[model samples]
Target: MGKARANTIVANTIVPIAGEDEGDSRLPSRLRKWGSEAHLSSAVARLEALLADRGFERMPWLAVAMLAGIGIWFALPGPGEWLIALGLCGLPAGLALIAMRGDDRALLRNAAVAVPLMIAAGIVLIWARSALIGTEPVAGPRVAVVEALVLEREEQPARDRVRLIVATRDPLDARPIRARLNVPEEMDDPRLTAGAQFRAKLRLIPPQRAAVPGGYDFARAAWFDGLAASGSLLEQPAITREGGGIAGWRSRLAEHVREQVGRFSGTASAAIAATLITGDRGAIPDSDGQAMRDAGLAHMLSISGLHVGAIVAIAWLVVVRVGALFPWLALRVRLPLAAAGTGALAGIAYTLLTGAALPTVRACLAALLVVGALALGRQALSLRLIALAAMGVMLFWPEAVIGPSFQLSFAAVIAIVAFHNSRFVAWLRGKRGEGRGEGRLERLLHAGLLLFLTGLVVEAALTPLVLFHFQRSGVYGSLANVIAIPLMTGLTLPVLIGGLVFDAVGWGAPFWWAGAKSLDLIIALAHGTSSLPGAVLQLPQIALWAVLACVAGGLWLALWSGRLRLWGLAPLAIGLPALFLARPADLLIEQSGRNAALLAPDGRLYLLRNSTSFSAEAMVEAMGKGAQYGVEPFAEFPEWPGARCNGVFCQFEAEGRVLLVAQRPAEVPYGAMVAACARADIVIASRRLPADCQPAMLKADSSLLARRGGLAVDLSNGTTRAVRPQGDRHGW
Candidate 1:
């Protein structure tokens, strides 16, 4: 049988094991004999002894269970009555299992007890979120005349975009609404500053759902952010008032940095510097941003844990040194404590200055935790602390659990911590410690090896996530990081921070100049590495369940201790191969319905719509063809020599099937639909087609596209297979 059949067999086999009751008489006699009460009694005694010796290592498992529950909740199609029924049914069984496992006093320490409690708590968290932030849009899509205050405006090359807080949708009825607007480049309104009031006709629409099945979802993000809708201004606004406050201050700060830094750094470098310093990334060129992502230096573009940690470390060092200059105060006061306090203050100030984005907030929490631990003379970077930090984030922003940054940041740190304390790693270190050599060359080689190994470990841990979210792996990320991280972590961030302080004190020019130069080098490294052969690898889309399985297995490997840890290898083995079994669609149509692409047998992408370059680039990247490498429109950038296109339509043949794309009804060529009904496998018409032309062809018109947001067709098995927006798709 095929791999799919094999997986089905394994899933069928394992699911029963999870569902089987201990006393089920239907179980095989051999299994019943193996799982007799005597065996169960001995297992319980062993578990008790183990707990007595170790004093319950429950935090890691509890945290894992909670995280798993969150993942499960998000993966669910919808929160229906059945979910509550399922939970209600399971809760009693869980309670019974706990009761049978131990007495009341012992239940608190039992993993069996904690697992069910955490799962229920996670379900409750999701249920609460669903109640507070209902899945439905707050307002339907419609045109409205509104008076609004501009919260922020982003200056882009093509046009300017503004975030508005609507004071009233109607003149008589006042209500507050958060929205985003795009103002044309032709309109250079001086009154567009923060808190400036204006009345204009706007088309407000709810956040769009996932374009394709398993695609990006703006609706969830919008719900969390309390964004009512986004739209464009119909005409010049009638100004009502001038503005001031925090929003105004931030705007001025952004403008000042842009003006001052642009003078010395040039527009490109200055844009990068401004984003790092102010968290306004609208000015950064799309090409540069693409390079950063492709080269695996996208982390540097944002203010994250690494940047926050560096800032705190520098603050701590500076405060400690300054204190040393005053011997009297240094002797009387706890210098380290004073330094830690200073670092904590610095972290909080920076977080606020940068708008306190989610990543920054998470980093600040961790930095504060470290400082607090230091003040109390305890270990700062322990597993328990990590668990607590994760729990805290989840308690406040449970939805963040699904975000890429949260997953990547937490996974990297967890892997480092787990490996740093592992017996296998300890044995390796011991072996290294046995060497007495301390030559310069030896030290250099050792450092390089260590960096490479660390990168390998992090990449290994992030593989499933990268493939699931991005579909492309940064193959040369370690090499790129080796050259780029020290420059960023050591020089760029510090110089930038120092430059900001000096600028405030009227002595900043030279520091900003130095930071700009550092950025240029980093950008150069990114471009060079990304241009290297095999620097990025695209993989087939894996199902969410498979990704979650990989996560579960990884957590087991990282969190479990002793012999049980070995079992993690089983899931890892199963999950990795399952990824290959789920192949990419042979053809994909973007949500726009007007744009589509086909996957050539040799792994090239042939786009249908050449006009939609930006969205096409994104689609290409999501398909594992790196933006810089993917083939464009078959007419211009031919990947399939036989592909043909004209002014209004394009046609391509793949896997013995002909697919036709028509930009307009007129492009159909009077009798083409008649031929398509019998000859062509699929016809995608952007505009309405004549009733007679719709004969029996697999017609994908606007109506069909509305129901199935985007389309993915596969013909690898000599039969037509298609994926719709529904969760019924096999892979994703």
Candidate 2:
């Protein structure tokens, strides 16, 4: 009886009795102990434990913090001296905290202080760089006889023009300035090369602002590039000096490549060949470029990470294989070190040959980092390396952080690395391992699957950025890349490079022909894919907050490890749908007040003027509809319901309010305009309005537009927004 009572006591200790459940009753004691430990005493303890697990893995977050700071700087309308001061004060405080935490066991204490300081440091760095690189742009339109030295020249075969970046002295202040000049190709002067000096009668204007809200900001890009003005020559320039420099060499090589390829193939093939070799994409036809963009293969034309990485990889492989042929050399030398050195040199040479554009420079830096890691017998690809490369770029060119190229390239790489390192991929790899005795066909199928999956991942990663910048994303890009990428990278590029090398020995014709034929196939594929149904997904202008949320969520997902990272889906869920939910404005007015577009009830755009100018195109795109939903002239659509038009003015009713548009006010009598205005709820006029011609709600006339820049109106709530508001002191 005593023994039975003891057995019952032991059972009670091991398992919960009926109706007294504490936790999972089936779990073993060992697992129960782990489960209990997983539940921390408090939220603070959990956070501390999380920080400890992510100690060194959190280093990449510093780069993210820096990017956030840089973004903050650009978003400010003014210099933000107060922000700089705050950062300066905060930096030392953070450092002091770290210094004081000498032997603290809490990792959260260090992380809590470190992250914000890094962000502050980023703010300070970008501010200093901006001040150092500041340039005074041309104040307004002007004509001057400018003597300048050419810094770079780009040939536009399709446009029959040559564009030049020239350094000249501003006549107004005698300060140095850089201006872009367009000259006709018909007057192509052999002397018009890099290092060439010329004098010309020039017409110069400051870089243009965005035509509509949320459009590309050319002025901001110009500011970062140190370009003060853009213009065209009034007449033929007189060559003052001959040209000779690295730029001249690059130009000549590009021409040679174009001519050689054109002789065997066609003009389009030649243009693509030149782009692949020298990164001169201006010569590509507009239609072809658009097709490439639609197919999501436009990155091929740029000398960026993909090209550089391929070149480095080829160099490394060639060196290792060739060295292995000689037993003595292979046995004595460290083949990897030798190959890495050779690959680094090859990457640098290629970068210089491609004009060392900003993207090329960035790629070269990354390649060098990879090569250095290989030489030291360390892992070549990691998020840590990516973070270092990004931080390097931001330190030198903080402005690039805002550009699409930098953001897209880095985002794609980050997504790829993070996805491949996930537990899901590891499980997939184990599944493949289980089929180790499978046939060659199985291996090929596996490779194809991996390629397709990678393409999808890249497309998914780049979609948000594409929509944020271009307002469109390719839907069929993953399908297209599954075929196009192999053709271009595996066949076309290698053959083209080999042909160029063989050209030095006068036996490259066959190789060049092969490359051209392969390129034609890829081009055809691009056209076919781009023509498919729903190839592109056009979205409205996404709000800045939505983009920020997406970026933050993406970083969180990419930077963290384990199931906790899944929490990032929350922000992504909010942001991705917000891309479609943004409401486009009902009315758009150009800064001149001469051009305007109204959103009709049927979701069609009605333009004041029937022209396909920049303003018209911008208005149509801003409506969040495709270009197929084209704009019709108000004069042609005047017979539609709730609308009437005469020679000088148009009257329309929108969202329960009447609108009067004075299109040709100068041609009409003042009494007629006054009478028309008095009956309307809002009046938009081409010229300044008289005080007596006031409307009930608003009067957006020439004077108002001049002060407000461009305007967008929401008719539902009768709210107006400006592209540039009063007191905006942005340099751009």
Poorest 10 consecutive residues by lDDT, candidate 1:
723-732
For each candidate, give its TM-score against the true structure: 0.83, 0.89
Q: Which digits, one per residue and each the tens of the lDDT, describe model 2 over residues 203-230? A: 9888877766777767778887899999
Residue 132 of model 2 has an lDDT of: 76
Q: Please, what is the whole-model Cα lDDT of each candidate in the order they appear?
A: 0.71, 0.81
Off by over 4 Å in 2: 1-41, 80-106, 186-190, 626-647, 664-707
Clashing pairs in 2: none
Which whole-number lDDT from 0 to 100 does residue 438 have in model 1? 70
Residues 1-732, candidate 1, lDDT per residue (tens digit)? 699999988867855775765565556765677789679778777776666655435576667666666766765555564277447646765776756654633643456566767766666676577568643344456676777877766666512454444434522233455776777755547567777888878777766656545666666677776666666778878888987776566666766776766776666677777777777677777777767776878888888888788888889998889989999989898989988989999899888877678889998998899888988899867677888888888887877888988898888888877777788778867777888767789767777776777777877898788878877777777788887878887888888888878987889888888888888888888888878987776765667778877887888788767887789888888888877576777766766676776677777666665555545655565565654443444433234667676656556666877766666666566677566544566777766655555533367777676555666666555333223434532111
CA lDDT for candidate 1: 0.71
